[model samples]
Target: MGVADQINWVDAACWNGTAFDGGWNTRLATNQDVLEPATGQALWRVGVASAADMTAAIERAHAAQVAWAATPPRERAAVMLKAAALFEQHFDELALMIARETGGIIPKGHHEVRESVVLCQLAAAMPMQSQGQVLPSTPGRLSIARRVPHGVVGVISPFNFPLILSLRSVAPALALGNAVVLKPDVRTPASGGFILARVFQEAGLPAGVLQVLPGNAEAGEALVTDPRVPMIAFTGSPGVGRRIGELAGRHLKKVSLELGGANNLIILEDADLDAAASAAAFGAWFHQGQVCMASNRVLVHASVVEGLKARLVGKATHLPVGDGASGQVALGPMIDAKQLARFDALVQETVQQGATLEAGGTFEGLCYKPTVLSGVKPGMRSFDDEPFGPLVNLVTFDTDEEAVSLANNSQGGLSSAVISRDVGRAMAIGEQLNAGMVHINDQTVNDDCTNPFGGPGLGGNGSSVGGPADIDEYTRWKWITVKASVPQFPF
Candidate 1:
């Protein structure tokens, strides 16, 4: 059946051009069916926007950027403040919708919704707090640098953490006075894209100020290639991010990408075994281990490896898994069948080689049990490669240097964690690991609004998308000079 024929689609389908159903059924000729990963139910479908539709959307965003940029920063901040409240007011509805669309458990879905409110509030306050500086100049002349928005910004958000991930960038871009064209993941158009559109549009934001295009890669590519969009913000795999970065660089357009990471967690001899195990469990298994900054490998001291394994495996064995939308499971199903197959294949192949399948690592339907593997070595794929699933490989080290080497061995450096009895020692070890965000006694998946969230190497390029620093990413500095008298020049 065509997506237009689906009944639930009327409630969940993402908006097209700010209109309900947004004339997509008539203009868009192609459609992609969205499946509920846990239940295999046909939830809704997304339209593959034609080139004409994409062009029209970009043009509208471009036109809106002019007046929106001219509006005072305080007024823009007010709009964002209201948007934050809207998100809070509709938190329950959005959370349940997110759980259905993205397969996130109720608690995680709630976190996504609640945190988004804070993200918007924090971003709203940034324009007022962040200001340009004055530079020293000659007498009777004043030199100043002022920040200005880069006009229209195209945001390509991912499916995982749909609400927080998309809004984290959108809220900041809008707060900094840039009109945003959000291209949410096709897999999660309703909760990820359209809900945000509704919140902002209803909050009294002018028409065309925020547009949502719920399509696939074609839409994202069009947004990037369009001259109307001066900035591109994306969150996804590193390979895609690299290509986008190269293209944006060629076009002289501003871009920021929060890409993939194969992070690590180090457990010292003095570390508490139970505490370390709990942190590891939450980091590697939460959200089905889809977090980009999750630890792909755990480096533990040889003296305490056995004890930590006992505790971790026990937790993994008893945890329930499946049906995130309606059931209270410890870990939800994988995003889709393809993701499950990829994750299963990696674990199977690693076990076939030399690794021991300790506790879980089996799949039933689209859901997979939390898996633990030991005896993973350097050559094995599970050692360094990030599966972005509920899997963790354990490797032991004798000294702190070996631990540090194991941690920094990955090509990507998004985040890492150090667990130890000594805070001073943990801080010392954290300094040595090559990661963008390092946790002293916690897990690798850290997303604090106040901290700048990004990484080095394969992780990302350019500026980050969080904290007040984001003002610098969505806007550029321009120098203005005023003189009481004409400056004397040697002519």
Candidate 2:
């Protein structure tokens, strides 16, 4: 059997103004190679929905949403529960597949799967809490307001955290009675497909209720522009997100963007150097810092800067970097040559600009060394740009005020963290930070199913997409009034 047959990918898009035929492609449609990042070799052929396919998906999903909205909320949640069970049963297999596609370290892949399972359960419980309000009314009339589904949601997910990001949106949308036309990043189709499409299919969701169309930018553009898709949930880089938001705006569609970060990890003078160093090492190098919420910039108090630097460099140099498929690798190769090249260029540029390369700045194949730079300043490119790799730019500040200034200096504000022994003191400093999600003695990479996620300014458009608050983005409210007696109006 072909890879498409094995994966059961949706092939031709039905754009002849009719219904989709459920066809699978004989071979990969696009010329793009689906490569294993560590080896830079083709893993498997991929072919999913095209632009026309996405258009058909939108129409079909719109049709499906009407019935889904009529289904009891508890019944809808049941399907989500079943899907979550399927995801749990196949957790290890799914994690391995994700590692293959995105060069995610094995532990990181497992972490994503576990988090996805929690999110699925959270989505399952959403329907029970999706309640309408009975408002106060006059004696002659009854007034009420209820939340209703947006019909269909267009989900555009990123390469990193492929399963968690895509399913996190898909589950909540479905729970609230909306269908989803998910366009996952083309580079990691299997990661999205296995966990989302296949698991949900096995869980017996209604046909066309959830369609995973894995293709390039054209497919994404089609999803964004489709007339029937009323709401869009996207997670990616800021530049692409801005463009997507612009197009969605032109079409008058609701779009939520969870863009990446140039986040900060602040170590106050009161922080324990050992604990701070461990957090810094993991925050910067985990999955080679491909995480959207990774701590790229570290602001250390001048009083403890030397001690923190010594511990951090000591910890970073000990991390083993290689292919994740190999035994127990602490760091993994970047997703592709393009990302590795970008990482190399930026690290080199920062070093040339006079930042001390204290620990690492070397690579073998796609694996870049975990690097630490000591002397990054306010205007340095490394301080401003989100490298999105295994590199940390260290900047020292004299006082608490200076550290807060250094932390809030960036345009991006997706994630921020403050390390201090005093909880009262750290949270106060956290309040001063400009990012959306603040961490007290925690890594910037932290997340949970119950907490709000996303950022402000350059990070994103300030839309939070997690927990109960996410329902606001996927559903809208409508007011209904019934008059018990005929209205007496003078015109």
Candidate 3:
């Protein structure tokens, strides 16, 4: 049987008041097929659920969350741990599906799945780690603050890194005792919804505690606007994020949004050219440069500009571009046809604005070659816009002040990387950059599970969704105090 016959497109897992009961509609349409450039064969057809069904599921989840939140944090952590183990056991399958559905290379897809599992494990350990402080107040009176979960959290995830991002929100929410109603992006729902549902079920979580409603913007908007859903965690475009924020604000709902970014990479004169070039190539071309944190703009010192440009061009050109399912392929196609058009327009606009195309400016089917542009001015669309493709714009600077100024010129403050042999100089330069996270002598892909990670300014709302500190973002703190001696005042 073909993939379409074997897989269910509209697979719904909902909490119907008392229990989880929903059927998988395999015949559902993705509206199009993801075709391989070489063979022109269909890889998958992702489907979406209706908005009405998703709204009902969110209501059901909210009803069940009241009881689930009453459970102790330690018990909830245990369930997360079990789910983590199940995810690890089926990592290969999950990875394969993610690659097929999202057009990410196999190795990258596997890495995302591994990170998702690690996120679950970290979330499992969050209950004990989510500690509050004791206030230094009056003597003989004890005052403490405790963190509590938001009732029912609605998680809206993106297409890129479907499994990891979805699990990132769901695991933390679950660990904090918040029942989750997840809405995976319509483009790659199966990769996240299918694996997560299977893992949660295998871990023996109660049906209503976790539910997946895979659908498009209508379903996502419905889930977010519902009053019962008190918190929303969204990862997507800035325009959509702004709308979500406005809606949540009107309804008095708490929201954490990780939006789009045009990240910059700064390479100083004292930097190691070989290492910087390799890091730049990875940051610009890895996963087809679809990541929100990907270094779309590069500022290199004029002294080493020629050498760095040569190295980057060579490295980017050699990367194998093909279908993600092919294990040898280093770069994959853009997420969809619309994204390809957008990327093409950005490149063309930059060229028209007088930027010189250095390596590539061609497209075959949905595959856009790793493209590099030089002589790009600061205000061009390519320099200012978010190119969600394998494209990098390079600019040269003479002094550290100029480099910092150019880097901070944009509105995005998601992430930045500085490559230098001198650790002290790198650290000093890193301090001057206005990004939320910085990497010295390395790329910006080093996201450890033990450290807080999030974008800044227009890129993010200063909310960390991973690491030991992430639990704080998912919960609210309340203070309690008791009188030392029942006030000796007579009535």
Candidate 4:
């Protein structure tokens, strides 16, 4: 079946919860084709939102915020729960569309959809969670502080993991009584923005409560600087995230950023070589290494570096790679040629700096082979820069201390992992690493609805989302006090 048959709303203009602007559906000058990365086929043509479009969406969201926030908490939770149900009902369809839209394998498509469902369900529960607490004050006064929603939240999500990342902010914000204006990546507008808006709309969300605007940097800057949008949630590269942080600071707006990472995975000498190899392979090649949490640098113990490398290379060479829409494959195509070129340049520079290419280093269409590099150490391009492709760098460390030092040597510390047969020892090493999230016996790429998802330094602004952190990210405390009568005061 064609993609249009699978997703009926692919041709609609952007979902702004307002009257369609003249630019939409007019095939105007700003319209761009959404291409299937693997085949370079145009799946749909969408109207790119301009700065004016962004302002309109945010204004609508801001106008709707008061009524949505006043809607009973149970009513809000009900709508979110229904949205979660709709996501579950359309899981397979959404997964197929994700694969076609983003060049992700079937498994990754399903994973993204499932995580988005989990996020919806998690957000549904927030309405019932304790929003605030009563505090002691004078005998005649009752003082309390309660969490209240920011009027409107502007969400800027990336192309990778589009559905879940966008929903992570949208779900919680709406459930907490805040309206949302989401600006998904221009590349995957349907899966990231339109599909989400469709789901929530079907679930009985009121108009203007959630708006999806697909646009470029101008729209993003408008969303950030809009005085009405009190908070901005962004997930993307470090450069753009830093720029957003700076702009938000100048406007005195609250911002939460989830940026890029050059994460590390360490294999101790005592680690089960087979298991460690499998973990490393999955971490580096899963989703074609197009994830912030992908294991970019592998720090293995000197005694077992060769052993682990052999197993990892064996896995890399055998894993299937192809167009995701064709069938199940271990690695899918890169998002596009630009991203592929970026990753390829990093690999070439690293090789020129003396690292040995062990397994694969070529491409077929957008599918780059799962590549493994050895003799990689600090200061090498492959070791320092994040390759958001199917590539892994192998480095050797003599001791656990050295392993920790090497792992901590990067400015980006989003996630880290350590593999060892000794659980306590691995845990100790994981603790020493500078990453926000650490795994003792697993790989660097990991996620869950209940865990806090963020890191310190370049990974983020030391702020977090998911689980309990969502409350802090989406709401602010408002102190309220009441008394039966005014106390007599001597002035």
Question: What TM-score fits each model?
Answer: 0.94, 0.93, 0.90, 0.96
Clashing pairs in 1: none
Model 4 bad stretches (over 4 Å): 8-29
lDDT of 3 by residue, 152-253 (tens): 898889888888888888888887788888877766666666568767777767777777766777777888789888899998888898899999999998
* Per-residue alpha-carbon lDDT of candidate 1 for residues 249-306, written as tens digits (9 for 90 to 100): 8888888988876788999999989999999999889899988887778889999999
Off by over 4 Å in 1: 1-29, 485-490
Best by lDDT: 4
Query: What lDDT does candidate 2 reach at residue 461?
Result: 85
lDDT of each prediction vs. the true structure? 0.81, 0.80, 0.77, 0.86
- What's the true lDDT of residue 327 in model 2? 50
User: Which has the better lDDT: candidate 2, or candidate 3?
Assistant: 2
With a 3 Å backbone cut-off (N, CA, C), the pairs that clash in candidate 2 are: none
- Model 1 scores a C-alpha lDDT of 0.81
Task: Name every residue pair that clashes in candidate 4.
Answer: none
Q: Which candidate is the best by TM-score?
A: 4
Kindly provide the TM-score of model 1 when superposed on the true structure, using C-alpha atoms. Answer: 0.94
Deviation from native of the Cα of residue 152 in model 2, angstroms: 1.0
